[model samples]
Target: MHMLKKIGFYIVAKFVPLLVIMLTTYFFSRWLTPSQYGQYSLVISIASGLSIIAFQWINVTLGRLIPKSSADVKIKIINSGLILYFISSILVLFLCFIFGEFIEDNFKTSSYLIALLAVALGGFELSQRIFNSEERVLAFGIFQGIRGVVFFSFALCFYYTEYIYPGVVYALIASYILLSTPNIYKLLFLRKKDFIPNSIKEIAVFGFPLILTYVLLYVLNSSSKILLTVMLDETYTGYFSLGSDTVQMIIISVMGVVQLAIYPIVIGAYNKNDEDRYNIFSKSNQWVLLILLPVTAGFIGISKGLFYFLLPEEAYLRVIPIVPFLIIANLFVQLKSLIFDYAFHISKKNGKQFLPVFCGAFTSVALNVMLIDGYGLEGSAFSYCIGCFVYMTMSYLIGRKIFKYPSIDVGFLFKVTVSSLLMLLIVIQIPNDSIFQFVISIVVGALSYIALITTMFYPQLKKYINSNN
Candidate 1:
């Protein structure tokens, strides 16, 4: 029942908002030109990417610190993070003014736009980090939903009013305000005793690697835009950004469900020194692969049709060839994030596990620099995908060395990979004649995956299921 409530709550809280954003995006894209939409995406991405420095390790610290921290210390940590963020925001604002016009001239992201994004981003981290620590994940989820609605509502007004740029900017700024609303209550009501800040240094030390990891992740993930801006134009950047946002909405909405549940549970077990419960996480590695593999395969299989069907015709025509590779890269990227969170937040690997992430980030930058000149956004996509693979592999190796967990069943992974490939082949054969066919193909592919897992891989999962039962 608890599980059901959690799943239900999160589904509504997370996916509902995501759907709102997706729907809004669909309509917004229709109303706005591709270049206009892409410009919005670029600004947001750049703002988000740049704000990484301001956040430092606060998000990571909250997850680990909250479980172990007393209330007083938590408050201090929150306050300090907030204080630090504001300071960073001011510095970013100054930098933006200095280079904002240059970027606007080159990248189509204006100075005013950069400054607004910087402010929104700074406030966003504080609110988001706080909710994350309290495990009021429902609130966190609702925050995202509200932000989307508010922003979309604002955007709608602006788009219709013919103030395209300002409307969009207002929407972003408004979302940040709305998202930060709940945090005010948190700030006012939560007591000094209910939070902890004494462990600031340790928290920072512990979160250092994750800070580096996530920053690189931002760079790695957003490189497509950066490359697009350089290789193509703001117009092309807009297109890639739209598709990328849609993909992210899908991937994050799905992945967020698992992560929200996994974190509190893992932390609870760790706090209690429950090895058995801690070991439950090992099973997650398998479960995530089982779930993600076929989804990735399906996306890759139906790349052309899916792109055409979901996005605008312009995007559909331009983005088809690149979507599959991008989705594939995104899948691995999602998994790597999961692992990083589990290692840093749940398993309490201190800061050491971040070594791979650093290496992966460095590799990603090098790859992007080398590849983007030759291949453009496609090159960036390939680099990111490869980067995710490298990061996941390294995280696994480092995690094992630190935690000494047993290896996952390689045989099972191989079998699932094979099953996914087979299912993909079958899915590809189905002629996409209509919506019905698409729906049927999806159902068939899903069932095929289930059948393969249950029939061929049942023994492996059965043990885990029975154990839990």
Candidate 2:
């Protein structure tokens, strides 16, 4: 129903464009030298980092706040979030300018690239946040599609014109601009404006906790690359990031579908405050694991071939060892996110839930700094794994202490664990022919997962589907 439709739309919107963008980026990297590709990766990492830091939780705040208020009030929240984002972007730009020379000299990015990257970062945050707010899921997809089109088209144009670096930057800037245009138009015209909140203080209050959550979440996710950048060098940072990126494609692509479907359902459940709804939430997590576990195991098992086929040989071969670890870590990270972040937001404990998040963030940052220099990317992976484990454990304890919900299902864990382990075995025993091994691994792993779910978890899924229908 609604959940399926929304999830379907979200997947189409986010993943379709992402697939195009990934293909474009892959080719772009192939066309460029290792150093050039490394620099490209570095700039993108920094831009993403800036977006994370600058986002300030407004998007989450809006998602929570918008439906609760009158349309006018929602408009105000949107405007307020936009204003906050603009100011934050300006602050980020200032910081970049201040550190630009040092970063370029030491970190291998040029000042001009940083400046352009700053603009791209700002636009990306604003437009993406607004897209989430509008819940114009298809529009969001189109926005991403436009970004890919503009980026690849313009870059190719510039590549042909013998302006490589500027071409890439121009592509990014133009794509962001194009993607953001719809929001800009909405902000400018379509003039049924509402009571714009006079003070952003209330919004800030709600958003501040998520800001902490976002940063901690960032640490959980991206701090590895940052630490790698510091502990090793830009080139290693590039390799580690690419490997992380490869695994993340698995996590995010899958999780993205789950989030779109489950989030609004969670919100509806919270609003209703019914145990039945809570059970639905629990079952959904089980379903996510039922699907995610084998996928993760397969990725870990066949990561080398996947990376090699998808990326340049040099980049793929060097980063192969890191992929399996990251894939596992990403699974834990996704679990932590579902149990901790989404669970809290749904249960209305977001206001007072900063403690565990801060604890995890500090732990992640500390462990990353301590580990990455010694073990390089492996250390970062270990830190991520440890941080998410602690965070999820803490969050579950706190969630139980506060809400007394059925925090997790033991049956769900047992089934998923068994399925994941079995799939891992099947995949690891894959043959020497790389392509054949990959194909067999995917087909066999998927069939095994579906078989398990149909036999064990199907009853629960059927009940949920029947109830909804």
Candidate 3:
């Protein structure tokens, strides 16, 4: 497939699941109280943190190894990965059971079942990454879309039946199970093979350091919620989570697609020592910033009005103030993790990848501990943004020294920034008292951006767009 078409497919595939989740969250905000929503958010955060700790290295390993392996070697890697996953899943479950009380006390919920579901979710996630590494974009998308559909349908059912919290959890568990079916078939039934010790050792060597990397990232992302839950209450945590989720929706909608689409290509290009690798890397960053900057601005501009329609009035008031900070934080995160961090991965400097995130995570936790008590929600937002900035700066410096990819064009970046600012100016002027007005304002802002980009940078944009064609 053409690179652009592949990216488009991956984007559509990724976008469906995100869109479903977004809709689900919108309805969830309306139906559940802040406290109820907070509990659910806590469950999700804990589950995600635990899952990442347990299985993310395996995912990262597969992502690195699969694309570069031969057909026979790929099967061996898959078999080895399955063995590792089984062992890791068992260990994780046992640890969770041991620490069940501590988790329950900290998050203020029964966590044993959630932990079990998290192991399953981790397996499904690992499966998704394997598919991604193999360039099975369509299959990956289908699995994600199915999971989204199932979760949304079951969540709605549970809500109407008045079993909201348990319903959501059950829905997630069910979707994960369904998603894992194809993976099970691929590993156990279709390509059944013995576990190779050498393969296991190789994957472990490559993947183990990534455990620390992912754990630090989890801390950077989730420490705010954990701290808020401890310092104040689940209600505040809920508000904070809503703010993060709002920005995350934007990140996944664009950055997530780009990251997924480009990573394998970048890996292949590096492996073959392709001359155009720098061009691909630079263009990816340029396009990502071009779309991401304006979207972030529009979201910040429309946050109050958007939340007014999407969230309960009380929840809206609590969350709206923190949205812009969270948006900025996520922007830094996307640029750091999705764009600049590629250099580290491609260069096989996996250990070097640890420092920037560790610093950010440390900064985030320290600031959250010191600031949340005095400044409350705003403090968490501020701490997060500062940490993200620290991470991005470090990653950019390190990436430049190590790989030396071409920088994004100054003229192009200026044009994108100016166009986005113009869009923001027009968007902020539209009265957003109602949903219709909000929708129209977003459309106008987007069209204005498109118009400006087309007029101002038409030649460059046209050449870049046609390059892959």
Candidate 4:
């Protein structure tokens, strides 16, 4: 399928579900205190990290190989991946059981929560990877949409239950299980009896390094909130988490569709004609900047509007000031993870990918320890930004040594930057007196950016449209 159509399908796929999540967050803020939400966020973050550990390798290993593999190899990959999934799930749960009570007290949830979440989130995530790897864009989108609706419905229901935090989680787990039901037999019964067990060894060698890499990545993402919770209080953690989560949502919604669509296509390009891989990578990077820069700039442009009933709760209003920093920081983080570090996957020596992320993670943690006591929340945000810059820079620098570096079109980047800045200038100048006006400004800014960028590509677009007709 054409890349544009794939991305368009994913836009609906990601957008609606994320929209539901964003709205759900607003309600969560209204429904629970910052401290309560902080506790909830902490548990969720830990479970998310566990989910990454338990399932990421399977998804990523398959994702990297599936596009180019023969049908027999694809079956081996899936079946062997399931074996790894079972082993990892059991291992994580066993460890969680051992540390159960301590975790519950420390993170403010049942320790079993991680076990459930690791299974639930990890299970569906593996399925999504399969859908994306197979280029089943519509299936992927529908799966996510269903999860979003189920999450919304159950979350609302769970809020009134006695154990609100755990109930919220149960709602999400239920959704994953609901969608995952049909895949159960397919995952188990469809396994080839003649599968080579060495495929398991092959996967371990390919993906083992990623385990620690994810620990560092998790530090870059959530350790700050954890540190805040320890250094100050859960309220502070909640404030920081809300901003970070919103930024994460935006980055994923914008760039994730591109990455998902591009991953397999680029992999196919690498296998068929290695020389074309650079072109594919380069073009996709350009598109990422085109969409991400303007959207991020616009989001930061009127970020203060977030406090104007977007959060609804007065306590969360405190987060507005730091939200922009988090937005910029996370933007760099995603650009690094989704774009630059893709070299490692293609390099097939993903082992070497660890150092840059380690350096960045160390930087963020050290800075947080040094600054958070004095500068407080803002310091954590600044540390995060600087750390992300280091990660992206180092990844680009080192990643080039591993594989052919995708040549960045500096000229195109400049044009996109200029267009984004102009759009930001126009949007920032708009009076944000009312929520209505604030929303209009966002619409206006988006349209302005689109118009400016589209104008730059007008001749090519016109030629393509004319040729198509």
Backbone clash count for every predicted candidate, in the order shown: 14, 0, 0, 0
My TM-score estimates for the predictions, one after another, are 0.83, 0.84, 0.90, 0.92
Candidate 4 positional error at 186, Å: 2.6
Ranking by lDDT: 3, 4, 1, 2
Model 4 lDDT per residue over 1-469, tens place: 3878878877877877777767877787777678888877887798888887778877777787677788878877777877777778788878888777565476534688767887877888887777777777677677778887888788888777766766777887888877666556666675457456888887787777788888788787776898899899999888887778877876777788888767776677666466677788777777678777887898878777655555864655577777878888877877886677778877677877678888888899999999899988899898888888888888888988887877777878888899999998999888877888898998999899989988887887899899989
The top-ranked prediction according to lDDT is: 3
Q: Any runs in candidate 1 off by more than 4 Å, and if so which?
A: 1-9, 70-109, 185-205, 208-213, 271-278, 344-355, 431-436, 457-469
The TM-score obtained by model 2 is 0.84
lDDT of 3 by residue, 147-244 (tens): 88988888889888878876788888888988887656655553334556888898889888888888888898889998999999988988888778
Q: Indicate whether candidate 3 or candidate 4 has the larger TM-score.
A: 4
lDDT of 2: 0.69
Count of backbone collisions in candidate 3: 0
Which digits, one per residue and each the tens of the lDDT, describe model 1 over residues 305-415? 555566788777766666776787788677766654465445566566557667667677778788877887677667777877787778877766656453568888898
Provide the RMSD of all predictions against the true structure, rounded to 1 decimal. 3.8, 3.8, 3.0, 2.6
Clashing pairs in 3: none
Q: Could you tell me how far off, in angstroms, the CA of residue 217 lies in candidate 2 after the best superposition?
A: 3.6
- Output the number of the TM-score-best candidate: 4
